[model samples]
Target chain A: MIRIKVRPFFQLKEILKEKELTIELTPDSTVLDAIEELTKRLSPSFKDAVIDKNSGKVRSYYRVLLGGRDLHQLDDLNTKLCDGDIISFFPPVAGGNRAT
Target chain B: MSGWAGRILLVDLSSGKIEVEVLSPDLKLKYLGGRGINSRLLYEGIKAGIDPLGPENLLIFGTGPLSGTLAPASRFTVTAKSPLTGILGDANCGGGFSAELKWAGYDHIVFKGAASKPVYLWIFDDQVEIRDASHLWGKTVPETEIMLKQELGDSEIQFAAIGPAGENQVGLACIIGSNYRGAARTGMGAVMGAKKLKAIAVRGTKGVKVEKPKEFFLLIEELCEKIRNSPIYPRLSVYGTPGLTTLLNERGYCSVRNLQQSGGFEEIDKIDHEALMPFFVKSKSCVGCIIHCGHFFEIKEGPYAGEKGGGIEFGAIGPFGTHCGISYAPAIFKMANLCNQYGVDVLGFSTILGFAMEWYQRGIITLDDLDGIPLEWGNYEAAIKIFYKMVKREGFGGLLGEGAVRAAAKIGRGAENYITHSKGLEWGHADIRAFKGYALNQATATRGADHLRGIPGGELLGIPPEEAQKKFGTAEAALPTSYNKARMVLHYQNLCTLADALEICKFNTEIIGQGIGIEEMGRLLETATGVAMSKETLLEVAERIYNVERAFLVREGIRRKDDAVMGKQGQEAVASGPFKGERLDPDKFNQMLDEYYQLRGWDKKTGIPTRKTLEELGLNDIAAELDNL
Candidate 1:
């Protein structure tokens, strides 16, 4: 079993309401797998907001984070999950000016 | 200038004569307005092969058809042959000035010859006057803005003026507006100085008219809604551009320590957008914009406590923070404030200073050159001190005032090796290794190394895989892939040039993403200008405008090799972070460039638009003119 922790930022938190969520998933579960499980448990409106019903795919700009890094840089939707891995769902939001 | 005041005002300071002439209809139709119109006029009016900084050079301020209208972010463009790049240069500025210029009923103002003394232009609707500006000449940007507002007795009137640095004609000096916003690249302010023009003050309540008001309003409302709901809107609204620190750090695109390495700032947390928001007092808008990305800040409980300044964007933050190795938030804010007050481009200032620090470290520049001030990385106080001296053009700062390219050339002993720049302009915050498309775009941008020239929209938007694959012929092609990025860049360049000519902000196009294409843009233009247009026609006009500007560059002696990025720098891998060991492949870049030029109907070998291509684009006159050159 793997424990996936989710967090959100800016307006994404407003949509999520809850600061954090923890769910059990099968070992080696991908981000897409966890999102599917989470959406099934969520309200219809929340599910609609998270995934496009027409295509049954995650929102194009919706960001899925594995730990602190963006999943887009990793294996994307197929990125494997591990035990006690922290995940974050960031809706498409622009970044402010800051020095790297 | 019809919908305009029907005249281009030319002020010759050396001759002390102000001449106004009506703009030809063909010029207006072909060039449209803003930077495009300005470049066309400059090419036609100015003698070819003239020195950019001499009395022969002309400095122009152009307002587009959408400026002073209900269009969002309809700003002004400052255009000239740059003393810095020795090529075509244009910089856009957002504030109230451009709108005011339109209200005063002139599409563009052209200044020719040089003045024996400093002078400022005052325009009140139909009335125009040039007054001696000996008193206003030496003032800093903030002080000058305040004094001009007070002298004019109307806070509502807009003013674009230069500071002491501009008066000195420093190559990187920028013409600042309302103390913060500025037309801040390619040394446009120096051109203003060469003309001996101190400032331009405008006031007029005469509003602009749209061909179809109802349709224009409806379209504007829909565009506004789209912009508001965009995923990118919140970040821009909350943090301006300072929010990119984390992303740039993670992606290894941040140009740290003059591109010596990428990523890892010790005080990154302190300078991030979230940390700075608590100091934000209000949000400000440009012209008719509702987005109001400009933030006003008031610092509390720090060394620089009680300091009130406008929000610093990504370009300012990155150079001040990563390039200078200064990580503390307060220090960065202070440095930004100093640059703002002095009326210099922050990116130019910081990049030049970064080179000086590197040179000093390499024993190329000594303590004697720095006037006993130890040039060290992360030394915030020292950095601020240098900024003060540079603005004043005093001591060691005098040499530094010439900008990185000139300063490096003067300081021999491999000093140029440390200067990371393209066409005399330093690269902004977005490092090229992580985003090669931007790198190539910067190299060939009409303005030197400008990111706004070709904004990477699709990559930033995270386009859907199937749609991306269909459009690009491969999914990877849409995802910042080096393959075929040049074609994508050319598309963006045309789109952006069209946007600039229309005087709309890049944010409008980017936020709308794939939802709004050239078709939507054509509809907006038709409704605004009362002229029928199709997407293809508008794009053709954009292509023609681009070719005309390129022809001007070619006449100015710009070659195909000039478009290529500097060696080693272009191929060097990012040293650290998420994209460590990533470098742009030269072969792929060249291949992409070849395809891009071929698509544009340009000569594959020289990268110049062929005579046939120019004739097809309805630029037969330009083609003939290029032949003579």
Candidate 2:
């Protein structure tokens, strides 16, 4: 099994009741597999927050990044997860002066 | 024609004269008012080589055509020659001021020449008066507003005022209005000070009349419904911009300790959205904005307990909380209030103060320079003291009041190495090394190092690369790498320009993933003015306005060379945290810049739009003027 750090930020932290989490994933597991496993462990609200009900799409405000790159940028759900990988879940961000 | 008030109020302060001119309908169709019209007016009014604070400089406030209507967060623009960058300067602020100005039966207000004595402009519908403001000159923004309201005896009147920061001609001074809202950048307030003007107050009973009131109301209802149902509405109404705090740190994109490190603030937990939750009392919004992103906070417990204010957004918090190495959320909130009251741009204020603190830590500056103040990190006391001094332009604060660039030069003690600015304007928020597009965005930005003008937030916000590619026609945009990401910047820049021209808040529209887009803009225009505007035409107008702004800067000698960061942003790698070794790639930046220039139909070497490109955009006159340059 490969271990990944699953960190939830902003409002997600309030929902998770934890700032960071250690998720155990089977080898060769894709990001989709990791997400499903991670969400299954959380409350239903957290699960709903990760994925939209009507569209079955990940909500735009919830960002899942592997290492520093968003998982969606790299092979999407098909992207392979590696040991010691950090997957972060970020909430909606809008800034007047912030560049990101 | 229907959306416009069809009048421009001209106040010649030097002559104590007020005249009203008809706004040409053709000009309205082409420019669409707000920043677009303001830039056109500034370009026509001001000549190069004149002092930005001289009597020759023209200060203008242009409201969008849809400003007084039932449009979400419709705002106005303040345009002037910048005392900060000494170039084309404009800033936008939200609240009822723009709509009130619009209801006064004018699309724009132009202030010409310097007043011989302190004065304030008061407008009651079509009637204008230049009243003596000697009694109000040195008051804080809050004080001025209270005094003006009491004098006028009308609490309903909206106002824009400058405080001691502007009175002292601080280069980073901002014009405060709508109580905590401000045209807060590039020292627009200093221009008002230079003109010996103190404030502008207006009260109007006239209503905004559109070409098709029924159709406009239909469009407005539909938009309000869409905004209410949007996925982001709940999060915005709840967390506001504080939502971005932990998210930026999680991505290792947060600027910490003057960007010496990327993320990993020691007290990150103390200032996250959750920490600020206890202080959040209620939701607030501007004019017609339904998102209610503004949160009214009351600090119930802490050193700042009982302190209350509004408009505590990313601009204030990013620099106040993250960059300054401070995590006492209340202090951050309190400091932001002080900035609002003092009439200074929070981003610039916090940055310069942070710069001094970092310099003190690095031994570049010492206790002697700061009059025995330790200047320690996270020391909210010193930061507060400095902010007070900055507004009053006293001693050490006076030296730093000219902004980071001039201050660095004046210090001459290797302090320049610590300062981060482009064209004298301090870079706001992000550590450019961590974000891929920041270097190019900073360099090419007209007002200098501004991120809001063009943002690729969709890439960072988890929009899948394939999805973004399908929408924006760019694969590299979803990633911050220099591989053809310039197109993404251009795309957002154009859309944001559309937002500014239309006076829609970017928070409810573009930056928060999606709300108002080109289609919505076109529909709004058509419904309000009975004009058939396709998405393509709207985008063309946006592009035209952007180029006109660029041309304005070009006239003042801004070229490819001026479009650059201080080099430290790209040259020095991040010292610690998740992005320990990240730095901007020079080669990739140049390649992407070449692509951007080519895409813009600009001369690659000079970065100026070609004559043919100008003519194609229906700007032959601008082309002729640039030819003379």
Candidate 3:
């Protein structure tokens, strides 16, 4: 099994109640697999925060980046993960607040 | 005419004259209102080679048709030739002041010439007066507003005031309105100080008339609902813009220690958005806004105990906290409060502070230069002291008050190589090296290195590939590192122009990945103003406004060379973090510029609008003038 470091930021950090954590996954696991692992270990609200309850798909505004590269640029959620990869979950940074 | 207040108040301070001019319906149709009309007026009123801080410059305050209505986040724009950048300068502002100004039965207030003595304008529903403000001089923004309200005997009066920084005519001085809102870029307040204008107190009970009130109300409700339902709403409503701090740091996009190292702040957790949550008093909002993404906070138990303020956003924390190497949240909050009270632009002030720290580090400046203050990184005390000196124009701070680009020039020790600026204006908090779209946007924005003008917010927000393809014509447009973002930038620029013209917040638009798009805005405009504006026609008008601002820049002799992100900030690769070793590619940047200019229908070589392009936009007069140039 490969181990990936999963970190939460912004509201996700508050929801997860943890700054950073390590999740164990299979060698051929994709980001979706890692996310599933997170849902199993983390709180149910954490799953709700990242995925839409209605669609069961990751929220559009929620960003899961691998080593600073956006999932959209890589492979959406299907990109395979490697051992010791750093995965970070970021809450939406745009769309709300007045532009400063 | 239905949506417009139909009057423009012109104040000639030199003669103590206030004249009312009927706003032409054609002008309103072409430029809409707010920044769009303000830029057009500035372009026509101010001639070339005039001192920006002299009596010759025009200071305009403008609100749009939707302002003061139930529209979400209606704002205003203050426009003047920048004393800092010496080009087209305007800053969009939020708060209740714009709504108040609109409700005062005037869409625009244009200040001309200069007053021989200190004065402030009082507009109480058409009873306009220029009163002596000698007593109010040298006061902070909060003090001015409080004194004005007491003097007027009306606590409901909304005010826009400048503090000691503007009184001293500091290059980066800003105008503070409605308690904490700022018209904070490009030294508009310096122009106000030169005019000897202290404050503008407005109180209005007049109502704005809409062409189809029912349809407008329905449309606004729909838009508000969309904003409330956006997935980002819950987080933003709580954390506000400070939420971007940790995200930016994680992406290696945050500027740390004057950008010496990207994402290099080891104490990121100590000062991220969550760090500020414990001080949060409640959520605040602008007039009629639904999202309410403003955090009102108080440092109850810290070094900054009893310090309370609002409107502290990424601009404050990024500059003072990360860029200056200070991890203390209370100190950053105090700095933000100080900037608000002193009428200083936090981005500009902190950028110069970081530059000074870097200079001190490299031995370019000495203790004597800093007047014995230890100019070291993370020294909030020294930063505060230097800030006061800059506002007061005392000692070395006086030299730095000339702004980063000009100060570096005066220093003359290859100091210019350390700071980052475009067209003499300093950049915002975001490090543009990692994001190609933002880099290009900063290079091409008319008002110098401004992210609000056009920074591809969809890409930053991580919109889906299919959605990005549908909107920007390619999935690559959604990727931050993609060079094929010319179309995306152009699209956002037009949208931003439209949002400014409509006087609605861009947060409620597609630029921020939700809320209304051009189609809905066009419908709202048509419904509110009885104007027949389809999306296509509205976009043409947006293009027209952008071209007018561009023509103004072109008239001022700004070409492709002037529109650049100069210095090591743009050239050197990021020193640390997830996106390490990333620097802006000059060739890719130039290619994007070529594509952008072609898309804008301008000369790619000189970056000037062609006579044909100008004429086609119904700007034949400007076209004729450019022909002479």
Fnat for every candidate: 0.23, 0.28, 0.43
Cα displacement (angstroms), candidate 1, residue B16, comes to 2.9
| Local lDDT at B288 for model 1 | 77
Residue-level lDDT of model 2, residues B1-629, one tens digit each, is 67888899999989988999999976788888899888888988988878999999999998887888898746888999998888889899988899998888988999999998889999999789999999998898888999999999999989998988888888889998884788998999999999999999998778788888888888888887777666566666677777677667766677788877777676878887777777877766788887777777898876888899888786666777778888888999998888888788888888888888878998887888887777788899988887787788887887778988888888877788777777667873577665666567777777888877876667555566666688768766666643567777777788778888878888767565656787888887777767778888888888889889889888989888677677357467877765678776777677878888887888988989899889999999999999998
- Tens-digit lDDT track of model 1 for B96-121: 88888888778889888888888888
On TM-score, the stronger of 1 and 2 is 2
lDDT of 2 by residue, A1-100 (tens): 9998887775566667897889899999987788788767875466676776785656765677777666655776678988988888775533221111
Return the top candidate by DockQ: 3
The DockQ score of candidate 1 comes to: 0.24
Residues B1-629 of candidate 3 have per-residue lDDT tens digits of 57788899999999999999999988899999999999999999989879998898999999998888888646899999999999999988888998888788999999999999999999998899999999999999988998999999999998888999998999999999884889999998899999999999999888788999999899888888888888667666767778777777777777788787777479988888767888878777789788777787889886789999988888888888888898899998898899899998888898888888888999888999899999899999898889889999998887888899988888878888778888888873567787888888888888998888987887676677777799889888877878888988899899999999888887778887768789988878878888878888998999999999999999999998876788766768877876678788888888988999999999988988998889889999899888898
Candidate 3 at B489: error in angstroms? Answer: 0.5
Report the candidate with higher lDDT, 1 versus 3: 3
Clashes of 2: 0
Q: After superposition, how far is residue B216 of candidate 1 from its true place, in Å?
A: 1.6
Model 1 regions lying over 4 Å from their true place: A1-27, A33-56, A65-75, A81-89, A92-100, B1-5, B470-474, B511-517
Candidate with the larger TM-score of 1 and 3:
3
